[model samples]
Target: MSDKTSEAKVHFRSNAKVHEVDLRIREANVRLCQLCLWRNRKGIGFHIAPSSSSLPVICMVESNSPASAGGLKICDAILAVNNKNISEANYQQATTIIKTALNTKGRVDLLVVEQKFYKELKKNDISMISSSAKILVTPHSMPADFFNFPKHQPRTCDIHVNQDNKTFGFEVVSGDDNIGIYIQEVAPDSAASNAGLRKSDRIIEINGTYIEQDSNMNYQHYLWIAQASVYVDIGDDKSKLEATKLFEFVLYENPLHDNARLNLAILHFNPSHVHALETCAIVGLQMNHPTEAFIDLNQVLHFQPSSAPLLANRSVIQQFLDDNRNQSC
Candidate 1:
């Protein structure tokens, strides 16, 4: 038979929960492979050895053999083959599964756990070659709300200010031709500095009205505009920080209506902020804005092309966009 036909003959089976096992392996930074092994009538292609507990382990893989090409490594624990759970079976039973698979098909599928997981199991005093099965927790058994609950919410705080307070100890500048207001400076003892309001915080709203950049307004008017709206910043050093702190406290407690998206955009302003880009892309996907998500992910991939997680996320977004386009047609 041709190499392709011969390779297709081998089919291996695994007893371990594929997703759970794959997750653990990935967490452990181990590569997992589905091997297709083929043997002639004389069984010259592959060889297996029994471990101390009489369970099968990969002892040797021939160079250029089907096993080697399939990424079977030395000392890999044989978990199952062709639906047979070798962990609970004797050497003969395991070999029988391999032999039966080879006879029925031209090749057999071998499912083996990588060495790292085996070492971990051994380090924990668990027998690596034992016939006892390890029971894994299934997702269906978890609480119904386990995946539905939000893990975190925006933190809020309130700051009280006396009427004597004035200057908040910060300078505000219109961003990019007076399009939006941003914190330009925080004085050393200013209220803004004390309130955790970082420089470059884009002011989205004042009191209840959202601040808009108006080229017609002068910078001084913008500064004095919010004076009567519960907080004002003056030239005094003593109350500057206090008023600024109160303003920031109120702002943090009541984020803008589109705070999530705004926060992500602000974070991505730093070019090397990969996590920010990743979060932006994820939030975009969640909001059904695949185009936005793709833009963020593409920018990230340009920085780290080999990032597997980023590539996977991009693929998902691409698939979603493709599916949506197809449905619209």
Candidate 2:
């Protein structure tokens, strides 16, 4: 029974786009929408209706609250909460996720696919979750060409290394105990292929642990960076001070180094890194750092938009930016 249920979930997920094809409606008739909500004393201001009748729908969106403010409508089906696929979850399970995110993070990012014609999809024997229904942002999966790989451009990607249905078919050529590891080859249509791993992509850090790198000066930069990680890991004020200086030295050497900048940002508050990029951006904006806020916001927008963000609702993002920029001004 469990195996059959899991198989059903995968099928339902795969056929999400079938409605668009069968009905000949617009290709993006059911694109996912992310609603970022900030919790307040008044609550997030939305109610999820019983799904016994259908997929979970927003029964009511309180006026002038995070729900309405975040562009949630009257019937947006709750697809996922905090990137967890809940299409198969019950009402209690769904609400628990929302409550947890609000209680822990004080904010939540919801991926909903509320379509006007959504409720009618059952007539066509279709489900909501699709092949494109991604709750979490992942790495690009483009084929790697030899000439296309470059050293100067480094981007962060999250790969599900250990998964039941996925195979990690990439070869790690060489790695130093201190500098970094490199990807030598990736099999086609494999886990590494889906993760956009290229032949020349260097594996600098794994699960936040720095490893093996090149030049005497470069080696010095990495050494301090590693030491900073240790100091931060030690979780003491003196260690924080040492980490601060080490991270600062790394930034001084390479102004464009994002890890150094992110480390510095986290180190500015807590060295344990409990306050991550989003929190830092929030605090930065609150502290009147518009440049930092805008930079972080734009980076997030660019990375997470996917093809769905470019639809007719591009103004939603643009207006958001304009509004924030005006306030900062």
Best by TM-score: 2
- Expressed as tens digits, the lDDT of each residue in 1-329 for candidate 2 is 99999999989876765645544323324434344443222477677875654356665554344554454555456665665666567777778888888778766766565446554543433233443443332112212342244446656655443323333566543332223455545677776677776543566665455544543346556556765776777666777787888899988888766667767776776323423444666655555555665555454445455535333234444566689879999
Expressed as tens digits, the lDDT of each residue in 1-329 for candidate 1 is 69866565542223344444445554543323344433321342356665346567655554334554454555556766644456556667777788787677755656566544765543321232222332221121223332243333322212233455454567655544346665545566555666654344455545445455544243333344344233333434444444444444434544442433333344335546887777777777666678988999999998899999999988988898899899999
Model 1 scores worst on lDDT over the 10 consecutive residues at 134-143
lDDT of all predictions, in order shown?
0.52, 0.56
Summed backbone clashes in each candidate are 13, 6
Native RMSD of candidate 1 (Å): 28.3
- Count clashing pairs, candidate 2: 6
